[model samples]
Target chain A: MPRLDWEIYEMIERNPFFKHIGFELVNSSEEEILLKLSIKTDLLNTNKTLHGGVHASMLDTVQSIALRSLYQCPVTAMNLDVHYFAPANTGHLFARAKLLQKGYKMAVLEAEIIDENTTLIAKGTGTYKIVRNA
Target chain B: MKLPVTRSTFFEYLGFNSTKTDTFHLDLPLQAILLQDDGTVHPGVFSTMLDISMGATASLETNSFATTIHLNVSFFDLSPKENYHAKTNIVNIEGKVITAEGIVYGQDGAVAAKAIGMFKASPIKQ
Candidate 1:
């Protein structure tokens, strides 16, 4: 298991929304970050499947985490595009993210969510602005 | 017009409230649990609100259930830890597919984010 940077780990641990959603940090490396969430009743939509918001949230977080792994400054999401391929109704879901481009002030990343069966549930691409302290 | 749709537990968990008058609107109280490290409401909150509001609007208009196929969100401004409002309108409908657009307003009434969603409509089982 690669050790996560103390600062990044603390940020994730202190985030209240992450706790509210029960997100677990599976692992992290310089190249990527992985997050896990167990499907619960509270995570489902009216159709009894994983809510699109959950997928979006997980994808966004994982991608941001990947950026955090590479930069010390804070990052904010500028845009997120998500496509749902299948519905996940049971078991655990895993999200993996990788940085695709790192520019002077902006970064682009891609993330995907898969079920325990390795089924592609959803995928997203996000652009984030790296906030530099003056 | 009331939408014949069942509320999702995830929606309730986010503390989002919905109303339909001239259009579909969703309101969210920026709770402590929704804030990020920068004291700004997480973008996911806005995305979720838009997705739900737009999907609900599509479903209500089509008289069926709509599932999200694609959602694209552009964040124009970071929202403070304050109340937020979202309104959605159907852009077009073609057979089983519906396209909708939504805008989220921050406490200061500034446009926080804009979203376009495509959903697949399915017949409501009687």
Candidate 2:
């Protein structure tokens, strides 16, 4: 894996949707990444809980970020599966994603979202295409 | 029965306008907020759209609200489509559990994504 660089950090910071959702990268490496999102009223659903789409989006993003950090290349998601365990309404949410496997053209990842009390909110798995060109 | 649409605040913030075009069909106008930095819409946005569309389909078929238990999606290609459409149908309903499938079509008439989900009747609502 290429050494972690500053460009990725800047890319994440500049990502419009990432900022729109307010994801704060806590730590990241080739194998795993941790992201934090402070729950806000805008991010909630009709039930006053974190939106399901937010969980799906964070998992897809964190997994892609982890793969990009590992391969030092851009990637796109090919498929994703999400299972919700609990609903999160308030407090901070954390997402942890790990690269499970990597091939020449594809990578597999698993991720989990949890609340401040460590309650599991959702779990997801995704397959991504490793883009070789820019 | 008309396909259902979500009234969630998140959907509102994303500026997604969903309408049931016909029986078990939903149409959503995509907004710029749902796009990624690279111009393609985010996978999460697709997932959310599919989830709501499929959940609504299940509810309409069963005549009650349903909670999503699991969702699986396969994406094809990303496009700068102005709007997206989804067609959902009930695969089967056995007791309290229901399985449904949906396909998302881009404005260019390409199949952008496909999804199958499992859901159960909402205990709180039903």
Which candidate comes out best when scored by lDDT?
Answer: 1
In candidate 1, what are the lDDT values of residues A31-53, reduced to their tens digit? Answer: 45789999899988888888999
| Number of colliding residue pairs in model 2 | 0
TM-score of 1: 0.94
Q: lDDT per residue, candidate 2, A1-134, as tens digits?
A: 44458968877866777888888998765545789999888877655667767888889988877887888888889999999889787889999887779899999989999999999999999999998976
Predicted model with the maximum TM-score: 1
The residue ranges of model 2 lying beyond 4 angstroms of the native Cα positions read: A1-3, A29-31, B1-6, B21-25, B123-126
Give candidate 2's error at residue B14 in angstroms. 1.5
User: How would you encode candidate 1's per-residue C-alpha lDDT over B10-86 as one tens digit per residue?
Assistant: 99998988877666778888898988766777778888999999999898898888999999999998757478898
lDDT of 1 at A33: 74
Interface RMSD, one decimal, each candidate:
1.1, 1.9
Q: Give the per-residue Cα lDDT of candidate 1 at A93.
A: 92
Give the alpha carbon lDDT tens digit for every residue of B36-102 in model 2: 7777788987888788778777776777766777899999986668888887888999998999998
Q: lDDT of all the models against the reference? A: 0.87, 0.81
